[model samples]
Each structure stands twice: as structure tokens, then as C-alpha cells.
Target: MPGYRKAVAILMFAVTAWYSEARAGDTPTYSISIVPQFDHRRIEAIWRPIIERLEPMTGFHFQLVMEPTIPAFEKALNAGAYDFAYMNPYHYVVAHRLQGYQPIVRDVENDLYGVVVVAKGTGHRSGPSSQRSGQDL
Candidate 1:
């Protein structure tokens, strides 16, 4: 299976098991926070299905919390505002360091890369051409 699909499956099962064993009188609502890479509406649209699936399996209410920005999301994460979180690698590292958050699973097949694109007719240069002697940008 694709890495993302596999990760989601693992997440579903893990969450279901974890919540099923919770204390009887505990709140049934769980909050899941996702990094704000897009607008809140779009983020909700993408993640709502997953949360809905978990609700039936675990018999718990799931709330999707989308922050306005990455920093805000990180702040909330550190404050333990979320019971679960789906974050980028950098955010994951910082959250783990700051809040002792443990990673449950990851999309191993997804490799992140950085690319720089310029206009076709522009004379922009990179590497040796873009750098001055003894200086880098």
C-alpha cells in the first residue's frame, strides 16, 4: 500500500485502541490539530473524512482544529491543546522536543524536497553564478 494510506490505517487502529481503553467517565471528544499549510476550510475538507471514519470505529467524537499559521499550530501543540496532531516533519521534531509528543506513524514513502523556480525569460542564476566570492545567499 502507499505510505500515506498505510499511515492513515495505522493511525485509525491506534487511535481506536487507545480511546477504547480510556476511563469510562472521561470525555468522549478528542481534538486533532493539523498544520496550516492551506486555508482552514480546505484543511477541514481534507481531514474531515478521516475523523468521521474514526468516530464510528471508536465511538468517540473527533474535533478538527485548524490553526491560522504554523507558529500558532506549534504553540497550541506545545500547550497540549490537541489530543492528536498531523504535522510536517519540522513541526514534528519541534513538537517532540518541546512537548515530548510521541510519533505514532509516518508516511515513509513521502520524501520532502526543496526546489527553486524562476521565470523562463529571467536571467536568474544559482550556485557559483549567484554567489559573490566568499559569500553565499
Candidate 2:
């Protein structure tokens, strides 16, 4: 099988196990994907616990895809390869413009917007700055 098929198979196994275990209750089928970020191993390690908790708590099958490159991820998202995704600002905006992606939920504690700042002298960077203070960031 191809890599995506393998991934889907693995995810399906996890979901199936979760579903069987949670046979007492109704469950929604979840399809989730994370955007490409700089830290792959670290994030994946951290997220395992989150997934473990989610499967039991939600009693739903989850399908998660983690990619390591933005260009490739964008291509995949454009192809509608995922049911849900966590993407960055530019990609989020672009995806909305191109493919109609919108945020359904966010972690209020840490889901702050992006910030762009340039040196006092040059002032040649692109985009505007965040109005919020650094303490929140």
C-alpha cells in the first residue's frame, strides 16, 4: 500500500480499537491533521498523550496526519486529503481564500495571533504588528 494508505490504515486501527472499547456510547468519527511545523518529533511525542486522552474521553475514532513540510502539506490540504487541519496564519488565510477553511475551535490560552516586528532602524519587514503585549505571547 502507499504511504497515505498505510497512514489511514494505522489510524483506522486506533479508531476501531477506541470505538470497540467505547461501545457503551455513541461516537463521532474524527479526521484530524496537523500542519507542518519545525518540530516534528517533539510535537508528535507530546501529542501522543493528547490523542490517548481524546480517544477515551471522546469515544471517537481519530485520524491524524503529521507532515514535515509546508509546501507538501498545502498540496495535500488543497487536495482535500484531510477532514480537519491545524495550519498557520498565512496558510489559514490562503486556504480560506482558496479552499474555504475556517476555524471551528481554538485553545484560548495559547492560540494567540502571529506577530511581526522589525528593527527600529530598518523598519523594512512585511505585515503589521500585534496590538497585544509581549507577556501574552
Candidate 3:
């Protein structure tokens, strides 16, 4: 988890440096919006401790913002309602184009890939069986 911690610390440093320059002396409160993959409570539970710990180290305050749904998250993200956001790569592309958001860091420990789960005996052999059955498709 050291790599994860280092990434987060670096992110906080970037945020602190940027915001500090924007408003010198005053502590800045940045809103961090996460994609609504999990419920709000779960997201908060997972992030709150980390943010709280970073506050003192970074000399900034963080507000965790969670949207109820993916659409709502997208809407907020498009509006640039957050200073920081944890989003999928697809959303990151859209955000970068729309809001000039830059990627400061990324998770390199695990590779993320989408999975399609279909019921057994459904004759859906291919992962997304549109043309043919099984991997031959």
C-alpha cells in the first residue's frame, strides 16, 4: 500500500500547490468527487480517513462529494463542480477535453478490464455474442 499512499500524497501536494498559489495564506477547501460506483456512505467511509489524514500534511481541507448515480456524476463532472475527481478512463478523456483536467497520477498496481457475465446454458459463448457464439465470433 506504500505506492497507493505515495500516489495520494503526490496528488495532495499538487492540489495544495495549485490552490495555495490561487489563494495565498488562506486554507483552501477542495471538493473531491468520486464516480458513483459505490453508495455514498461506502465511498465516504473509504475516503474520509485518508482525506482527514492528508489535511494536516497538505495544509488543505478536502470535501468528499459523491453523486447518487453515474449520470449525476457525469453531469457534475462536466460542470467542473469538483476540484479533484476519481473517475474511469472514459470519463477522464471526456473531462480532459471539456475541462482541461490533467492527470496527475494513476493506479499502476492493477490492470482494470471490463467483464461480461452471462448465465450458463444461454448459448452466449462469446463475451458479447452479437455475431456468433463462442470465441470464434
Candidate 4:
């Protein structure tokens, strides 16, 4: 989680730089959109401290934008509604490809891993199989 927080901070700095360059002589209030993994209140609680710290460091105000769902967040991202975003891996790819959003950092120490579960009586094998592509698995 610390690694994730660090990545978020680095990304914020990148956003600050971008804003400063793009809007010179103005203290831009940037909006950061996070993936809606949790409810809005919880997300605000988790990120408010980070945003407070960044405000002093960057000399800019930040607004936290929380959409109701991931797809809604993606829709706003495609519309360029945010200046910075903290998104999941798949959303990161989509945002980068479709919206030209560049990644400043990632959580290297804590990478995301996927798991697949099946019922015990289903006769399904758990191990990797030749029939399964990486995406299918």
C-alpha cells in the first residue's frame, strides 16, 4: 500500500508539472479521478491526506472526482474530464490508448495479481493449461 501511495504522489507531481507548463502564471486546480473500487466517502478519506500534502508541495489545489462506477469513470476519462487519474491496470491501458494519458509511475513492489476460483466438484483443473491463452486465463 505504501508503494501504491508513493506511485500516487509521483503521478500527482507529474500532473502538477503538466499543469504548470500548460497554464503558466495561474494556480490551476486539478481534478484527480480514482477508480471507484470503494465508496466515495472511503475513497475521499483514503486520498484526502495525500491531496493535502500535495497541495503544499505543488502550490495547487486538487479536487477529488469519484464516479459511481468504473465504467462511468472511464467514460469521463475518455472525455478528458480529469487532469490526473489513479486507475486500475486495464483502465490504465484503455486511458492511455484512447485518451493519450501517460503513466508517471506504478506500484512496483505490489503488483496486481488475478485469481480464478471454481467449485471443487466441477472437475475443473486449477493449474495453467495449454488450451488457455493468457487473456482467457
Location of the lowest summed lDDT over 10 successive residues in candidate 1: 113-122
Q: lDDT per model, in order?
A: 0.62, 0.50, 0.61, 0.61
Q: Candidate 4: TM-score? A: 0.67
Give candidate 1's error at residue 80 in angstroms: 2.0
Give the true-structure RMSD of model 4.
Answer: 13.6
| Candidate 2 residue 47 C-alpha distance from true site, Å | 2.0
Model 4: per-residue Cα lDDT over 61-134, one tens digit each: 88888999988987997777787677767776666567666544455555573121211222333223324322
Leading candidate by TM-score: 1
List CA RMSD, all candidates: 15.9, 14.6, 14.8, 13.6
Question: Mind giving the per-residue lDDT tens digits that candidate 1 earns over 103-132?
Answer: 554555557511111112222222222233
lDDT score, candidate 1, position 106: 50
TM-score of 3: 0.67
lDDT tens string, model 3, 1-137? 44445545655554444434444577877678878887788778766877887687667787888888999988888777787777767887777677656554454444642111222222323322234222211
Global fold similarity of model 1 (TM-score): 0.69
Off by over 4 Å in 4: 8-25, 113-137
Q: Kindly give the stretch of ten consecutive residues in candidate 4 with the minimal lDDT sum.
A: 113-122
